[model samples]
Target: MRQMRERLGTPRAAGVAGVLFALLMAAAIILVRLALPGGADGTEITVDAGQRGAVQTALELLPFAGISFLWFMGALREQAGAGEDRFVSTVFLGSGLVFVAMLFGCGAAAGTVLDDGQPPSAFGRHYAYTLLTTYGLRMAAVFVFTASTIGRRLGVWPRPLILLGYAVGLVLLVVGADMPWSELVFPGWALIVSLHILKGHRPTDHPSPTTP
Candidate 1:
């Protein structure tokens, strides 16, 4: 009974964590975009007082976002229980961690711009830019892919959600960086999935483990 209760409770916890992660991450991304328009070509944008404040705010939000994401990811893995495939879990865990590391690295590099109360140099922009756009999205794509596969095979998620995950993964892998405002898609998907889980995630009823 305790095990079953814990199992049932995981969805709500994961949902809350996911929602927090999604909101914080989306806010930080939006703030960063507003603060640094034109990607690395943001000398003018950086100089603007309003944009500078936006960047500062984003920096503050990132740590909390990372923490929440870890919680969300952990709860999600917990939902899979002990019988989850080691290989799939490995990929899922690796990709999620990499994505978080990239996010933190990006935040650290971007913080340098506010150090001297001046516009960021090209050096800082390199880390802030590529870490966020280049590698981060790639890792996100991998995470999405593995997550969708596991959910589909386990019957933890519905068909439409799994399909959407694949689509989101494709977008993030292919043109996430080049496409404007595409970063928001990840958090958006997270929010949707989290809500679904919270609404009625019945893992015990899946029957996948018992099927002959």
Candidate 2:
């Protein structure tokens, strides 16, 4: 009974964390994008106070977003425990950790603008978004793919959710960099998945994680 209660509690925890992560990440991305609409152009630039505050707020939210994502990931992994395939679990862990690292990397890169009290060079802006849309999205794709696989294997998620995960993962993997504001898709998908989990979409009957 205790074990069952623990399992029941995990989805709620994961859902709450995921929702928080989604909100923070999306806010940060939107703020940064709005403030620095230019993608790597080294064109002459000015950093007005409003622009500076927007970016500062965005950067400040990243650490909290990353922390929430870790919590969300941990809860999902706990629910998948014993049923998880070792190789995929490793990839899942790696992708998540790298994504978080990239988040910090981006914060540092963007921070240069505020640090020097001047507009960063074209290289700095390019480097920051490159880490985000390029590397970060790829890591996100890997994480989503693995999570979908785990959910499917454990029978914890329905077919539609699995399909949605795959579609979003593909988009992130392939077209994330080309599209403007494309990073929003990750948070959007996360919000959907979290809502599904929060709704208690999983089966009530017990099935061994190692069964299939």
Candidate 3:
């Protein structure tokens, strides 16, 4: 029974973690996007008091979001069980780790701008933005691709969800750098996957038999 509980609990825990990761990541991204200037060139990054506060809040949330993402990844792998394909799992784990690292790197770069007590240099601002929206999200795209592949192979995710995952991955890969809000797709995908897992685990009620 102890082992049974552990077996049953792990996936649920992962689902919860995935949900948390999605929420936190989305919040952080939204806050940062709101705080930053709209231009792509990053030459005019003047932060007002409100923007400063928003950016600081986003930075504070990012580390916790990264941690939760790691938990989500682990739980997902565990859900894959022992028969998971080594190549796909390797790619999944590697991409996930790289994505988190890049996320923290972006946060650190942004924090440095905040710490400098002056407007960020255009180069620094562009560097951080590129790290996040370009390279980091591309890693996330790889993660999505590999994860969806594994899910499809294992019959874990439904066809529609798998197709959506593929679409999200493609967006991240091809259009994320050019698109302003494409980063949200990652957390959105995570939310969908998490909710699906939770829904799947819900206990079903049986109808009573009629008397003869």
**TM-score on alpha carbons, each prediction:** 0.92, 0.93, 0.88
Order of the predicted models by TM-score, top scorer first: 2, 1, 3
Residue-level lDDT for 50 in candidate 2: 81
For each candidate, the alpha-carbon lDDT, in order, equals 0.85, 0.87, 0.83
Per-residue lDDT for 177-199 in model 2, tens only?
89888899999988998999899
How would the candidate models be sorted by lDDT, starting from the highest?
Answer: 2, 1, 3
**TM-score of candidate 2 versus the correct structure, residues matched by position:** 0.93
Of candidate 3, the 10-residue stretch with the lowest lDDT total is 202-211
Please give the RMSD to the true structure for each candidate, in Å: 2.1, 2.0, 5.9
Best by lDDT: 2
- Looking at model 3, residue 6 earns an lDDT score of 43
Writing each residue's lDDT as its tens digit, candidate 1 over 124-200 gives 87778888888998999998898888888767898999999999999999997788888898899899989999897
Predicted model with the maximum TM-score? 2
Q: Residue by residue across 27-108, what tens digits does model 3's lDDT show?
A: 9999888778573475556777788788899999999999999999998887666548899999999999999999999888
Error of 1 at 32 (Å): 0.9
